[model samples]
Target: MKPQKKKYIFHPKVIKNYRGNPDLLRIHLTPEYTKVDFGYVAKDIYINGGWIRIAPETFIENKITKQRYTLVNAENIPIAPMHHYFETKKDWRYFSLIFPPIPQNDCLLNIIEVKNGTPNDFNYYNIELKMADGIELF
Candidate 1:
């Protein structure tokens, strides 16, 4: 049997040069999955008009290895063509995405919702995943 890898959790996280203003809330790296939690607060839109969704094909790519980790599942969010709308300007919607485990050695990734070159796309580039002294969960 192969040696098991330890699990890690990073809470209250931040990323470099994040675009489109979606908040990255947490990240859990486990033997089986790389889970990312996200949050978006309603802003600059009419009440109940702000909306968000994740494309079924959304993915995370390891920057150095050029390896793509495709999205496997999501929670508390809708797959695109569908959307989760905000009830008010102060409302915050939280969701999570699960992908195949990225090698712990890989420290940078791009979370791409799409590559259409629009500012509205939720594409976060060069997100630094510093595992150094990360809080081990298990």
Candidate 2:
């Protein structure tokens, strides 16, 4: 028959809030691993020219109007950064962002690292295709 293709049974929405440098980067979002719920508040960890901004507590969960979408007051966010070599490589340190699929509802993403690195800046880090069960399952 050869007509079967379906995996990733709801398991993706990570946010490892980073755990290094100058303190204040500790969020243990859990949803079996990382679905967000670390309860943010500890701030302090930024680097613009050297690349280092690990702030995650973002949002995008709309399970039938249970709304939880955020881009920090969104105003034209769309900074697709999959590979431009992150601007010709700066030692490339983990990069991911290719958003363009949202219709299943349930999104809550963020990356509030600022130093004015404009480009319609929407922060960084990415992933969230499917993952829903009963709200914040940790």
Candidate 3:
């Protein structure tokens, strides 16, 4: 029999405070890779409508061990220097980033996307890896 791979899924409840205001949807931890999903709603065209990109320097840091997992790949999102422009004020985008598997014991984490002290930085802090009610693992 094939060995079963261990997998963990987390739906973060922590609020994201940033200019882009991307909503973190889910976090998937597997033996091979850690995947993070995010949703970006296009609203307030005059204020926040524009383009968004995932910087190459983006990472997921374990709050306790301080171990950092650098981004390995991205889906439905463009890497930095390349922008994903909004077609309309109502246009929204869902994207995911993949990184090396996070250690199972590191329950708390932070997702940082280029920390430059700017208003448009997409940084989420203190993300607890726990399953939220109604989020089923498939």
Per-model TM-score versus the true fold: 0.85, 0.25, 0.85
lDDT of each: 0.79, 0.31, 0.80
Worst 10 residues of 3 by lDDT: 129-138
Clashing pairs for model 3 are none
Q: List model 2 lDDT by residue over 53-128, tens digit each.
A: 3323334344444544333321112232311222222233332222222333345444333434343223334443
Best by lDDT: 3
State the RMSD for candidate 2: 14.3
List candidate 3 segments past 4 Å from native.
Answer: 1-4, 18-20, 130-138
Q: Give the TM-score of candidate 3.
A: 0.85
Model 1 off-target regions past 4 Å?
1-4, 11-20, 47-49
Better of 1 and 3 by TM-score: 1
Ranking by lDDT: 3, 1, 2
lDDT of 3 by residue, 60-85 (tens): 99888888999999999999889888
Best by TM-score: 1
How many pairs of residues collide in each model? Answer: 0, 6, 0
- As for TM-score, the candidate ahead, 2 or 3, is 3
